[model samples]
Target: MKVLIIEDEKELSKSIVEYLSEENYLCEVASTHKEAMKKIGIFNYDCILLDITLPDGNGLKLLEELTNENKQDGVIIISAKNSIDDKIKGLQLGADDYLTKPFHLSELTARIFSLIRRKQFNNANKIKQDELEIDLLAKTVVVNSNPVALTKKEFDLLIYFIGNKNRVLSKSTLAEHLSGDFADMLDNHDFVYAHVKNLKKKLSEAGCEPYLKTVYGTGYKWKG
Candidate 1:
């Protein structure tokens, strides 16, 4: 999974990035609202941890920008502002969830997982498509009732593909999804092909169907 942490507090953002990275999520941090805007304008994430109060802008206005762009990226407000009005405005503008500061990272992680599931997998802990089964919480994949071993990056790639099934993903987008915004700093996306190749091999060896498809010169897609 991919997440963007938008907060001015260095310690909080650092802690979030560390915890979520340990949980197999690619995370990017934006200390200011302008930085957050730049990242969101360029890349899409599975979830965004937005702080309502920023040094440069209001997070609610960011929500409005997201709504205006019709972006489907899931949003969760992480703010110290506990007023009902702020929560209402955030939700009214389109935040999936809100967590007050001084909150538990575990709880925040749970909410993020829930939001991603609700947006991508229909709120099901286990996603099934034909002979393939994925337990999102367990971070496991089974094909034809057989467990498939995948590296962390490989597993993340699989989920990214499945969540965006049938959509043609470009190499750059895949790179960003797998490597966070650092993808922009890379010169080539050979790592993307490597990960996809490994994931495909593991799935095929596990008696899985040919769900991963390469788009010639473009990228890859998951087709049911």
Candidate 2:
């Protein structure tokens, strides 16, 4: 998943980014409200860790803007303010969770997982589609009782497709998910096609029915 962390504390933000990146999450940072706003305008994030106190503006105001935009991204307020009023305000403004300052990184990570599970996976660790099953923790895929071998990108692509199974995902969107910031540096999205082709071949070779479908001029979808 892609995450945007809006924390002004450099050391803390770096630590959070490093930890999440190690877990295979695409992460970006915004130390100021303006920077965060620019990022929110340009790219979509699965979740956002927002600090209540920002240099340029109140994080709560930013939350208000995000809510007004009807952005579907999950928000978790991370702030030094331990006031009940702060927590209540954030929640009433559509924040998904709240974390006080001096919190353990593990706790933060767990909260993120919980928020994502509730937001995308219906609070489940396993994602199921027809006869296919994926263990989120194990990072493995099984189809018809047989394990399917998948490279990192292939696995990420498959899980992403399964998570939003019925929606048509564009090549650009796939590239962003796989490559993060480097996606903008690429000249073409041929890598996405290559990965998809390899994944399809592997699944087929493993005797798994291919549910991936190309939509002519648009994109691809997993219709299972």
Candidate 3:
């Protein structure tokens, strides 16, 4: 999953990124409201950890912008402000959850997983489609009751495709999803082709129908 940490506290942001990265989440950090706005405008994240106070602007304003844009990214406000009004305001603005400062990273990780599951998979830990079964918590995929081993990047790619099934996903978008903050450093998206090819081969060998389709001049789509 991809996460955006909109925090001015450099040390806290670093710690969160390190911890979440260890948990298999790709993280990006934005220290100022301007930087956050720029990143949000360009990329879509699975979850956003927002701080109410920023150096350039208020985090609440950012929430308002997201609402106005009708963005579906799940947001969790990680603010020092623990007042009821602040929490209410953040929720009213569209934050899915609120976490006060000095909280446990494990708890934060759990909240992020819960929010993503609720938003993407209807709060289900396992997602089934035809003969394919995906265990979200275990991060495993099975076909015809047989396990299909996949690389971490391949697994992430499969989940992303399944989540946005039938939608035409461009190579740039896929690369961004996979590369996260380092997406800009990518010279080309040829790695996407390799991963998709390998994933398709694995699934097919595991007795799964081909659901991933190439869109000719466009990109690729999950036909499921």
Candidate with top lDDT is: 3
Off by over 4 Å in 1: none
* Candidate 2, 49-118: lDDT as tens digits: 9999998899999999999999988999999999999999999999999999999988998898788878
Q: Rank the candidates by lDDT, best first.
A: 3, 1, 2
Q: List CA RMSD, all candidates.
A: 0.9, 1.4, 0.9
User: Tens digits of per-residue lDDT for model 1 on 69-165?
Assistant: 9999999999999999999999999999999989999999999999999999999999898999999999999999999999999988888898999
Question: What's the lDDT of the predicted structure labeled candidate 3?
Answer: 0.94
Q: Output the worst ten-in-a-row residue range by lDDT, candidate 2.
A: 202-211
Candidate-wise lDDT, in order: 0.92, 0.89, 0.94
Q: What TM-score quantifies how close candidate 1 is to the native fold?
A: 0.98
Local distance difference test, candidate 2: 0.89
Q: Estimate each model's TM-score.
A: 0.98, 0.94, 0.98
